[model samples]
Target: MGGLSSEENASSKSTSILLQIVEHSDGSVSRPFVPISAPSDDRPDATVLSKDVPLNPTHNTWLRIYRPSVLPLATKLPVVIYFHGGGFVVFSAASTFYHGLCEAMTGAISALVVSLEYRLAPEHRLPAAYEDAVETVLWIQSQARDPAAGEPWLVRHGDFSRCFLMGSSSGANMAYHAGLLATALELLPLQLLGLILHQPYFGGVERTPSEIRSEDDPILPLQANDTLWRLALPKGAERDHEFCNPVVAVPPELRHLPRCLVKGCEGDPLVDRQREFVRMLEREGASVVARVDQGGFHSVELLDPIRADSLFSEVRRFICNDL
Candidate 1:
């Protein structure tokens, strides 16, 4: 009753409201895929131009890049390497929902957006997505080193020194882990300024109060969340694995990492865990900014345009001034 008002959920509900989990004999899982959005760069009316590039040719992973149509002569734009959320088991950079998201982000934040299409589970699992995330950053670094070899958008106007990682839901989880890995490696010339985690998906064997209150909610029910973790985490791993629960998993080296902005919604089942995560970040001596919406559900920005714009505004503030 306390989470996701009925009206809010109703606006997004459909025949596929509940994610029907199909567990495979090989320990993999499947779900109904949403409609995909293709990349575009020739639209004269559009403010942002988007195109896809191969990130890992061997693994079939690619990244979708979004940049403003008009170039800025005075200053290079900050780069935002983004990851889309689908509980690590669904969605892609090409998802219709995320395409619009990156486009809006590109225009509003005035930053070049690169949305990674990483390998998902139960096909890839855990560190696989995390591995791809770090690799994507490395690819960007390589591009920065050789402008001719990189996409003109990145080389011409993108600011490599002010790079940021932003992701939603499970993608946010990947951003956190990958940020840690990238920082530890000391990848030179390409600096990480900050991290943006939107309603991050974190869990544990024990339920938090928010999870309990929204166990039956249509949008991301507790059982659905557990199934996702089961299919995403390594086999035999519980929700307590470092990948699922960050409050207990932050590394000692995280003390000097880039600033982090963690945003959540009160109607989300994961809000309590996100709050605890923010506290943990503070306790660990990390610079953190936390914003919680008064009323909304998980990934509410994706469904509500006004909420999405509000989020974009906050992200703009964070990228332009806060960070």
Candidate 2:
């Protein structure tokens, strides 16, 4: 809803300051609005159908679903509820990048993909994203209990028993929080079988080698990372609030977490922390599979088709793997 500020107006493509959402010299705020892509059934591998469905009219939360067209009769596919990554301050579920990603995921995994569009921060802030993520799981459970309240695609063809929660970058942060909450929350027929965290965004007061070295990376820089936390986290809250620096300590609830797959990019600043997360999960005795791309940068999978195919292949394998 916000437009470009004076500083952003002057230096958009070549911004000098660390801020992605700029605060102008005159004290006005400006953040770039993401372009939304229309749902289409024209993907290359499969004719993917998609539509937007509101979760809660009051909170302005909603989801976009993507599913393959050609399916055998009486067949119900596994479900993937995805959260798009934008540092929790930018990006949209309806963005073309996410649409393409969901299309690939749906085709590769043969699953129903529900991409969530939750409230962004600087306006709504930290726990808002966390709360909405948890509410999405709860919302699905509600629909399962009452068919009249559910969406047609889910009610007709979605298999709640095989549902998986997935997200990339900061959205992965949301997925982690939600997955932790799901440990205690009751969802009858809808079981959370796994979690897929790709290029998870996490930080701490002490800088790691990747963060110290990646000063001006094209996709995500240390300053930009700090700025996103400043804008998204609770006001005056430090980055170590279990949500941001998850690897610091393993909580008891982790024992109840479903099997998890963590994807990390070698060229990403956050890769170290992602590795640390895997280590923590391991120490906690959680069932986990971790992958590190040799040379890929953060979110390159969303841009490059070959990379996307490879990444989605891994995702499909993770989701379809028998425990």
Best by TM-score: 1
lDDT of 1 by residue, 75-144 (tens): 9999999999988998889989899889887898899999999998988988999999999999999888
Ten-residue stretch with the least lDDT total in model 2: 1-10
Global Cα lDDT for candidate 2: 0.82
lDDT of each: 0.86, 0.82
User: Which regions of candidate 1 deviate over 4 angstroms?
Assistant: 1-18
The TM-score values for the models, in the order shown, are 0.93, 0.90
**CA RMSD of all predictions:** 4.1, 5.2
Worst 10 residues of 1 by lDDT: 9-18
Show the colliding residue pairs in model 2: none
lDDT score, candidate 2, position 31: 74
**lDDT at 58 for candidate 1?**
88
Clash count per candidate: 0, 0
Give me the overall lDDT of model 1: 0.86
Give the C-alpha miss distance for residue 187 in model 1, angstroms.
2.0
Q: Model 1 TM-score?
A: 0.93
